[model samples]
Target: MGGKVLVFGGLRGSAEPRPVPLGDLVVLDPATLEVERVVSGGGGPALSHHGSVPLHDRWLLVVGGWDGRRRLSALHAYDLAGAGGWARLEEEEGGGSRAPHAGLSGHTCTKVSDREGGVRTQRRFASLDTLHVDAAARRYWRNPPNPGRSDEPKGNGRGLIERLSSLIASGSASPRTPRALRHHSMTLVGPFAVLDGGECFNKASDTVCNDLFIYDTRTAGGRWYQLSGTDSEMKRVGHRVLVVGENLCLIGGRGPDGTSCSPEIYTLEINT
Candidate 1:
């Protein structure tokens, strides 16, 4: 919201997707094109596919993502007003700080409520009340009108392989849940979170998918609708999507052909 841009952990630039974890907190001056290191400790969370959102006037919250070997569930807060550094969210439990969920990466968390404030993280929709999420895989069930957070126990929620293993064990052998995506962007649109094109490796098909979907935050029934509009035929990944007035502007991304990057810019006129 200021002149400076706050950059969190992300993968190194590459044409093809590779696991390159970067945990540096950087501040960039758009006008001057200067860079500054914000995290001075050991380092920021060395993670990729993580999602960050502005917490308060002076803070930004970095949530779930991959940490090289495994997915991480630790909640980290970066101080923007004070000396910029990373700090984990500690809750008083038995005179000690207990850890939060550490099972997801490549997830998205958005501030859905202002009066009863909370951050909604995805992979599977879960409601945890204490500003701390414990049950990493609460599944997308019908929640109440008013969301109440859950205080489940600490556990490594199921990953893609694990879930698939379970389905195979049960003889169902079907892909039920949506695949995890990387290099994606989600923009808050009124009561909806508009998620545009990103890269997702479909283990079932062994192919990459570049699709768009939208989630309505106000609904008790957690549901996502696939969005297909103008230029939706063009498969795009790692692109920039922004809400401009009544239209959603989609900028450059990896083209569907996979040989080159997309140079064309397109926008979908929001009917609402």
Candidate 2:
């Protein structure tokens, strides 16, 4: 993630009516923009509209997405170091489960820490299912059955739930959790998970929001504080947001009407 760039399954844009699904995992040189290597997505299926995040800056964790016709339940990881390739990480909770990710697309995955009230964790909500975790599991891809030193936590790829439990155990999480949301923007700012607008997970009303919510990862239960104001009323979806200094820079994204809004960068002033 820091040195090289990774590309996973997507569609072939040149396809007629719609892009055809692809399953190749491509690694590229960040500077030269040249292809480093391409390989089959290990035993994973071709996917698009999925959520991906870097784990330890060495592996790419890929979770739920459309496998062409239907929503996929598999989770995959691409190793960026050594001779690692793609590896499908799964768990046998309750004997069998597919939607362990709760729909990963449009969700946000964050790396946080609640250790000794210091920090070190990851979590997911909605479509985001944090994967690609742990530096010790670098060799996991080479052999799935025999992960050797890969512990049960990292091996099962449950970084999200595991870290969330740890955070709650730290007695810093809020007692309540936010409702399921998709296409929302959630970023970390000083141990706090700040969330912005996204459509309701229900999709029945397709309600896009323009409010702000903050979760103090240092507290129990997933409690959040919602910020309301007159100026923070621009309904957003498919947008991107990041913390810049003391402000939040909202980037290009379509609005509720499903049309691209004006070419403007919105800023939200945040005090701590």
Candidate 3:
């Protein structure tokens, strides 16, 4: 079942803030060129730079975002089954509190399907994979590699590794730390998550990366790789990375200097 594509509350830096915390929800019907807005209601305070996911039966799960004054971690749900209105979801303990945690830009949340008689079915589903920038914490958190199910080598080392081993042996799981990422884009490709170009905050040179990294969820290991692209283009942030077939389409985003980059699209072929 397909629904509308609605975008709200993202703007170039210099542009005046949209009069409201949440911008108009732009709705587009997939089968036609028709587009319109449905007023969203009761979703707490207005929010920008937030993360939204379409839940079962046309409900939207709205998470943390910046609301001008401060960052928010309050969870709200919007029902799209009829007249849309927002409802709150209780947050897990130690989860991002009311802090601006990267505002969900460039992250991906995928609905996991259940299997029945060897066929995949999209029933009422929940996200098994979630990626976030966690700007406030300055790191990334992924679902912990399933213990007793993962095949990654439990290596031995003198310092941090040994401490980690002790923690695991005592049945204490490591709390997921946010990764060191800023202005990066992540998309799920099969069992792997691919991260694309964005600046890495380096105090020495303040370098921005045009590099690529792939995190294998199954293996719980990540490796960095470089991409071949022209340097004339400005460094991008808050861009949309959409998976269309086997190609990853890099769509519009703002540059490092807070200027909106000219509308440009790049497609990267994934080697499956």
lDDT, candidates in the order shown: 0.53, 0.54, 0.44
**lDDT (C-alpha) at residue 263 in model 2:** 37
- By lDDT, the better pick of 1 and 3 is 1
Q: Per-residue lDDT for 139-244 in model 3, tens only?
A: 3333322222211212311232233234334544323322355556665444444556555554345344444554434444533333333453545665656544
lDDT of 2 by residue, 132-244 (tens): 23334422111111111111222222433344345445643434555767767776655456678777765667477776676754444435766543443477875656543
Please provide, for model 1 over 180-270, each residue's C-alpha lDDT reduced to its tens digit, 9 standing for 90 to 100.
6655667665544567666665554423344556554345754565644345356666555644333455655566653355645566543
In model 2, the Cα lDDT at residue 242 comes to: 52
Superposed Cα RMSD, model 3: 12.9
- Write down the RMSD of candidate 1 (Cα, Å): 12.0
- Colliding pairs, model 1: 65-105, 73-102, 128-149, 128-150, 129-149, 129-150
Q: Which ten residues in a row have the lowest lDDT in candidate 1?
A: 134-143
Best model per lDDT: 2
Off by over 4 Å in 3: 1-4, 12-21, 29-45, 92-179, 203-209, 218-228, 231-234, 261-272
| TM-score comparison, 1 vs 2, better candidate | 1
